[model samples]
Target chain A: MERLWNTHIIEVGFDKIVEFFYRMSEVADKLRQEGLYFRYGPERLPEIIRIPERGTLRVKYGFPIFQKYGVCMDVTNVEQALIAEEAGATSVMVLDKLPYDVRSSGGIARMASINRIREVMDNVTIPVMAKVRIGHYMEARILEALGIDMIDESEVLTPADEERHINKWLFKVPFVNGARNLGEALRRIYEGASMIRTKGEAGTGNVAEAVKHMRTLMNEVMVLTFMSPEDRMKKAREYGVPYELVDLVSHLRRLPVVNFAAGGIATPADAALMMWLGADGVFVGSGIFKSQDPHIRAEAIVLATSMWWSPDIVLEAQSMIDEAKSMMGIDIRKLKPEELLQVRGV
Target chain B: MKVGILAYQGGVDEHRYMVVEACKELSISCEVVNVVEKHSASNIDALIIPGGESTTILKLMKRFGVDEVIRKSIENGLPVMGTCAGAILLAKRVKDLKTGRVLQGTLETLDMLVIRNFYGRQRESFEIDLDIQVLGEKPFRGIFIRSPAIVEVGQGVEVMARYGESYVLVRQGKVFASTFHPELSGDTRLHKYFIEFVKR
Candidate 1:
């Protein structure tokens, strides 16, 4: 409480702080007039470029998807990518797993597999994403440096590293992580994962049981969140009632990405329902082509998922189903779900 | 009379568009060349280092073994005009962020600062009117896209234009630099100036 002020402290101290603020203000003003600031670093950009968003909505959404989606088509054929593309599958997953081998193999074999994926990318117009074994963030960066659009941080296969999966946030390129369940999805999202995919019990190729399993889980999920079909419609209705409230899409866009209904998508309706219940998209394995109606059902499922709410979209989807079925010699709609026992715990 | 546009990265397309149109009106050939890997020095009579990620493109240039090739080409006295970050790379001295001090990027190619992304960020990008001294009479339009500021310049650097206290344009013999992006503005005067410089 002593008030003796025969000191140089205020004059020396506050004056410099005041001068510092004034100089900062001047620098800011200069930047306003001059467009240049003091250096931060050379390796990083002083700014991002703001070009117009040129692509369509699907394309924009798909940009990060295919750029980073993992578990690529294990096949050598590039045309096989067309199946995923036409299904509006954002990307074809390239798995490094030895497709036939119960035993995974050598480094040269992995590189050869990668080269084959590169060939597929060259033949296609869309961006190509690649995979890195978990905890392999350095390798992921190398892939990005090679002009790869994305990386899949999937747990489906990693070379049994001693450490935890490499954190995706450390890399700049978009990364898609495999979410085995809802908890994992949220965990990865918290860990700065930009995208997520449901882990389909892959490679077994049993179509119907998988579809039913996913449907049951999605149904259970509807009860747990505000993303239920009825609730989403209700929210849309509430927004429409105000009609003047802006930022409907902006808010929707920020919701943690839940694209790709995973595990089991046995039928087209299941695909539509998944989209209805707030999934950003769906992943089908054994669901479409492996089903009895290989072509028609796949097209219908794709169409329904792509254009869930709009009837005009439904018709277009139907036509797509028709065309795909005729072209591929498989009526996808005719494929019935495979039956299986419900494990008591599952 | 085909003009080569260094298309390694950044706003290469914008400059390519500007130069190509300038060439079309002047009946000169202009091509956007991926100068990092795919070009020989003799492929074009003159070069325009377009505004862009200067470091990334320069990294590619070094990785692809073209940095010295470019330095030698500039030394041989080819007319070169660099805009924004492009201007920075073409400068004889640049602020090397690694050492927190100035270092040489070019072989005294342009006696200018060519500060990298002197502008703060994309939101800071803008267009401004300039009182350019070299154009000789009229006010010229300028677009600055994440442009670098010329904090200092050597004696050979001619301060060609000023926007308030900041030097917006500078020229040193065949080399010229502007902190603003003239290509993005769609103004032909800068291109015309470079063409005239090349002709001289």
Candidate 2:
């Protein structure tokens, strides 16, 4: 009797399934007439299949939704974090050692101490971010447990796993990853990175790599926008990212998430240049703490980033800083390929 | 109609897109401007303060000498909507959620007391469907990112919506403020309501 009832239900459900598909196609046609089909295209149906709960989706997208633009200062200690916050920095990246120090002391670099990060969080009202080694899922877990605002699966620190990065989708707190070009950026996004930053050479105080990465990413995005659907799919395959993400980028003409310039940005002019080149914001690693006067320099960088469109305000910001006090920059050409930080994480 | 968004930092582009889209839906011809300076602030029909770090926006506004101009403009009956950090800026008093200390240098345009980061940190940020009656029967999704909470409202202020115990949306005369980001939700009802408010 139970078997007969189950078979009867299946037979009846089959026609309902067919009817459902028929109605869905009809709805799709109407949406196409309204020019909204591409936004909810069939190719994006897989994303719907993998959708998390509504609450989780909200937390996942909230990082970029409320991301504070302008200057994101990298600070090594509690005092530096406090100063950065007071100087109007949108956020501060907590580090166990400044990039320059990490370069000077050659050893295995790991996440910052929990106590120090806690102290910084206690001292400042602004958002606090911390870094974890590339592919270091354990460190990411630890940071998430500590209730850090954001995590950077950073290449500046040593890579914990050379083959794979931490699956960002598993974590609730948003993760930011570094990318040198559009392909790398889309790949990181596919891995659930909520934000992307240029993988410029860190601890060098040189903006050339930062400029090159930004230009390369922007130019690739522009090229993608002009590509045919078939070519975009081919590009997506080449990028090893989802086709829908590539298609979305082609339509939107920009990264799906906020893209900030990071690594070796120093001085007010450099920050402004990155902004002019289309960075959503900037991250100054060793620039502030290594400068002659960190407090004034931090404020100046914030000013330049906020008012990059106005040359007079940028000039005033530049005048506030003494050029002689700037960090001694390293020539990128002098560094061996093995010593370069940007080449670490895929 | 011309609308200006405080464009120094944060989600300026998001707000601009929402306003433009709302205007198009309403069939209202609109000019959207970035209110970066005094001249831009004073010439706009309505002003929007986009969500960011309130301290950062306040500091830059004061630095560029536009803070006072914006305050006076709103005082003179300029319809304004403040979201998230923008809402914090319009409060009469702002207190740190953790320290319970008062934050100084806000615009003090609205008669309310707000607690900054009242919902906790970014990890605590959320999105939920809210029943905003002023927006009609359809529920509006509220995206609260490190959002503040209105702890107290003055006699003149009307509470329009709430999340649990605290008020999330409030309006007094021509000034409207919401502790959550309506721009990020991809909904234009609140923007349409603001446009109508400006029209009136």
Q: Could you say which candidate leads in TM-score? A: 2
- Model 2 per-residue lDDT tens digits across residues A1-346: 0110110111111112223323434565677779876322111112121121222444545555455457889998888987998899999999988898898898989999999999998878888999999999999989988888889999999999987887786687888999999998988877778789998999889999999998899889889878999999999999997686787677667776778888788899999888888788899999999888999999999999888778888899999999999999889999888889988876
Q: What lDDT tens digits, residue by residue, belong to model 1 across residues B1-200?
A: 65666644444544655666666676665554535443555566787776544443454456446677777777787777877666777776776332244534444577655554454332234445676766666667555544567877888788888765567788887777787767644457778778766756
Q: What's candidate 1's DockQ score?
A: 0.02
Regions of model 1 farther than 4 Å from truth: A1-346, B27-33, B96-107
Model number with the top lDDT:
2
Instruction: For each candidate in the order shown, give its overall lDDT on alpha carbons.
Output: 0.49, 0.82
Error of 1 at A276 (Å): 34
Lowest-sum lDDT 10-residue window in model 2 chain A: A1-10
The backbone clash count of each candidate, in order, is 27, 0
Model 1 lDDT per residue over A1-346, tens place:
1111111011112112223223434544566458675421111211222332111111122233222111122323465555544333434554444222211232322322557666765554333566665656666767656545556664434333435555554444556666544434444543445566655543333333334434443443333344545554554354332111112222222223424445455455555555554444555544454444554555465455544545554455555543333212223234333211121001
Clashing pairs in 2: none
Interface RMSD, in order shown? 20.6, 13.0
lDDT of 2 by residue, B1-200 (tens): 99999988888877887888889899999999889888888889999998988878989999878989988888799999999989998999999888577879888989999999898887777667788998887778777788899989999999999988899999998899999888776678899999988988
Score candidate 2 by TM-score against the native: 0.90
